[model samples]
Target: MLEQHATELLRHTVEETFPLAREVMTLDARQYTCPERFAQEKQQIFSRVPLVLAASCELRKPGDFKTVEVAGIPVLLVRNREGTVHALLNACTHRGAAVASGCGSAARFTCPYHGWTFAQDGDLVGIASSTDFGAVDKTALAMKRFPVTERAGLIWVILDPDSSHDPADMLGGIDELVAGFGFAGWNHIESRTMHGPNWKLTFDAHLEFYHVPVLHRETFGPERSNRAFYFSQGPHQRVVAPRGRPGDTAKDDLYALGRLPAADEPFDPLLVGEWILFPGASINTFYLNGQRGVLLSIVLPGPDVGTSTTTQTFLAETPPDEVTRAAMEELCTFLARVVGDEDLPTSALQQKALATGLLEHVRFGQNEGGLQHFHRWLDDLLKADDAELAALLAEPCPQR
Candidate 1:
């Protein structure tokens, strides 16, 4: 399935043809500006759907853990001694205070506020002052645990503790291609968060490359392709440009495949593009000084309707040397500028305009199939109940 998509892209590139959707679509602008709608999205979509919180390599060893907040819910991801990953509510059972923050190795978390301790598996192992605090059932006071699954080198967690939905089902067939990347063995370099506009507004830019040439002219350059071909597997999508800047490493590598005498094997380089994990995450291929790398961007909605934070994690296929490390650092800095100065600033302005009630609808052109699919899925997910939502995701992905 992965190689077949690569072949399709190669064919499109050779034919100089990219398919477009049947018609343009319009979405209610208020979906991006209304507080009531944002609240529903938080509960229905953000809370219900499985979210990609970290790559498997981020917690490769037992006792490694990372903490992140999704839709205001603090989540702690940990790996136990037996090499199993678990997701727990970051709050301590004692007084709802967070037992951990940031990422590091720890056998147990001792809450700073009261000294309550929790094992990596969320077991309430120790109480600060057993006699003074009084006797209680430690079993009943265990940290809240959420359903979590690790697959295709990524870790997915459902914020809802009782959710019956399988996190793997949400990936659709995207895991096939992601597994090809062998991200489980990749080295985690660095991660940083950047503040942005509304979650939807910030994520909208990642679904389409229409504004790439104009918005990213200074960074990606004006010669870069403004057109892209979107392929979907369930709610996840890949933004593939049939053609792009001539000097782009991935593009050059892809075009070079056509020159080969016999292209029997799947050329891994051809699979390079932007792969978006639904709700809010994207993995974009990159090469630093000839070393393969990917930028995994996860966007989570903030406390209010008009704010979001994107955590960008850079990973390399192997440990980076000094030269490769320098290149990776340079690339990250450049991307920060491209997204912070260009993409997000534009989205923020759009949010401001939409908030004024001047525009009732936002139009997505036929070429913007990715955005159309995303908005449609979001609407459906928002309307679905627990059973309906599971049934919706369980349905097979539509064939392109």
Candidate 2:
């Protein structure tokens, strides 16, 4: 199946045939400006969906844990001695103080407020002065566990404890799409957070390369092609430039495929584009000093409608040497500047314009099918009830 997809891309390259939507699509500017709509999205989409929370390598060993907040919900992720990952509400049962903060390794956590101790599995094991605290069912007070699963070298967690939707089902086989990357064995180098405009606005810029030549003209535009081919399985999508297209960083290496036998074609070119795990995670491959690295960009809703936080996590296939490490740092800094100086500042300006109520809608061209599909899925999810959501995800995801 992977080879077939690669062959299809090669054929498109030779034919100059990139797919397009039926027509131009327009979205309401208010989708990025309205607080009520943002709140609804928080409830219906962000809270209910299985989000890409952390890379598998972040907690490669047992007893490793990390804490992150999603849509105002504090979550604690721990890898137990049994090699299983668990997601628990970070709040302590007694006074609701967060028992954990940041990432580190620990066998157990004790709430600072009253010394309520919880094991790696979230069992309430020790309570300060339990004899004086009175008899309470410890089992009933175990930290509330949310649905969590690790797949394709990433950690996925749903915020709702009672959600019927399975994280695997929600992914719709996207794990297979990225299985070639072998991300579980990767090593996380570093992570940093950057502020952006509305979450949707920040993510919209990633869905299509239509603005690459314009918005990223100084850096990527000169050598890259603006054209792209989008392939999707459910809400997850991969954006690829045709084989030998200048947009591909390895286009020179791919040109050899034209004369090479089909069986001899390399598989690396097929994985050379952006892979988006929906609601908001975009994974892109990069190379520095001849060492491969992946940049995982996770965008989560902020405290308000006008703000969003993006965590950029960089992972390398193997540990880097001093030279590669320096190159990686340079590359990371360059990307931060591109996003912070170019993309997000423009989005903030767009937000201000839309807030003025002067522009009624935003336009997406026929070529911008990715944005169309994303917004349509958002609409569908927003209107679905819990039961309907289960049924919706249960349907088989169509192949590209």
Please tell me which predicted candidate would have the highest lDDT against the true structure: 1
TM-score of each model, in listed order:
0.95, 0.93
Pairs in steric clash, model 1: none
Candidate with the greatest TM-score versus the true structure? 1
Q: Give the TM-score of candidate 1.
A: 0.95
Cα lDDT listed for each candidate = 0.85, 0.84
Q: For residues 359-386, what per-residue lDDT tens digits would candidate 2 score against the true structure? A: 9999988888888878988998999988
**Model 1, span 1-400: residue lDDT tens:** 6556667877888887889988999899999989999999988988788899999999989999999988788999999999999999999988899998999999998888999999999999999779999999998988999988888899988898877777777656567667878899999988888898899999999999899888888888898888887878878888887765476655226556664324665456556678888989999888766678899999999888999999999999899999889889988988888888888899999999999999999999988999999999898888888877766775657733
Displacement of residue 235 (Cα, Å) in model 1 is: 0.4
The CA lDDT at 199 in model 2 is 93
Residue 363's lDDT within candidate 2 is 91
